[model samples]
Target: MAPKAKQRRILVKLVSTALTGFFYTTTRPRLGEKLAMMKYDPMVKKHVLFTEGKIK
Candidate 1:
């Protein structure tokens, strides 16, 4: 018997800060995970920081 590994790859959403609630899924590492990234939004036509957390 062997222990199961935690999910190494996961689908996370990058949310827009413009309050448009626009989001898209991205692949990320689940181990020691702390993800904060800027992504482009078509509605706002600008980049916003998307953080990893329980979706609000």
Candidate 2:
């Protein structure tokens, strides 16, 4: 039998910068840096920058 390896991915919350209370959950590499991307926000009806936030 082989021993189990540690997880390399973690769940992160991407929050909209528009302050519309919109967010998305996704898995990412366990890097020590934050993630950010541009996505469509239905609340604002436009694309906006989404920054990484703690899942808790």
Candidate 3:
């Protein structure tokens, strides 16, 4: 039987830093540091920093 291939990407939650209880979902490489980006938040109506978080 062929060996099972490893998953290179994972689903993660990006939470807004503005404490607006807003978040986003995206796929990223499994082997790397936590992801962070600037995204628009509808709650605040402005761009904010989003940090990676667990899906659970």
Candidate 4:
């Protein structure tokens, strides 16, 4: 059998819908899945639901 994948964290970008501000974070997706999280956007000055989207 093949060895397990090494744990690795990569940088990701999350953007706010209201202010269009971007937040940078890291995530480890071993199975190759997108990361979705609800975090606080400082520019918006509130909590918002941010999903995995293209940075460019």
Return the TM-score for each candidate structure: 0.66, 0.84, 0.86, 0.55
lDDT of 4 by residue, 24-56 (tens): 556655467777677887776877877666656
lDDT of each: 0.73, 0.94, 0.96, 0.67
Alpha-carbon lDDT of model 4: 0.67
Off by over 4 Å in 3: 1-5
Tens digits of lDDT, candidate 1, 2-56: 9987787777776666778788777787765767789887888888876665543
Every model: Cα RMSD to truth: 2.8, 2.6, 1.6, 4.5
Q: Which stretch of 10 consecutive residues in model 4 shows the poorest summed lDDT?
A: 21-30
Q: Number of clashing pairs, model 4?
A: 0
Candidate 2 lDDT over residue span 1-56, tens digit each? 99998789999999999999999999899965789999999998999999999988
Q: Cα deviation of 34 in candidate 4 (Å)?
A: 1.4
Regions more than 4 Å wrong, model 1:
1-5, 53-56
Model with the higher lDDT, candidate 3 or 4: 3
Cα lDDT of model 3 by residue, 1-56, tens digit:
99999899999999999999899999999897889999999999999999998998
Which of 1 and 3 is the better model by lDDT?
A: 3
| C-alpha RMSD in Å of predicted model 2 compared with the true structure | 2.6
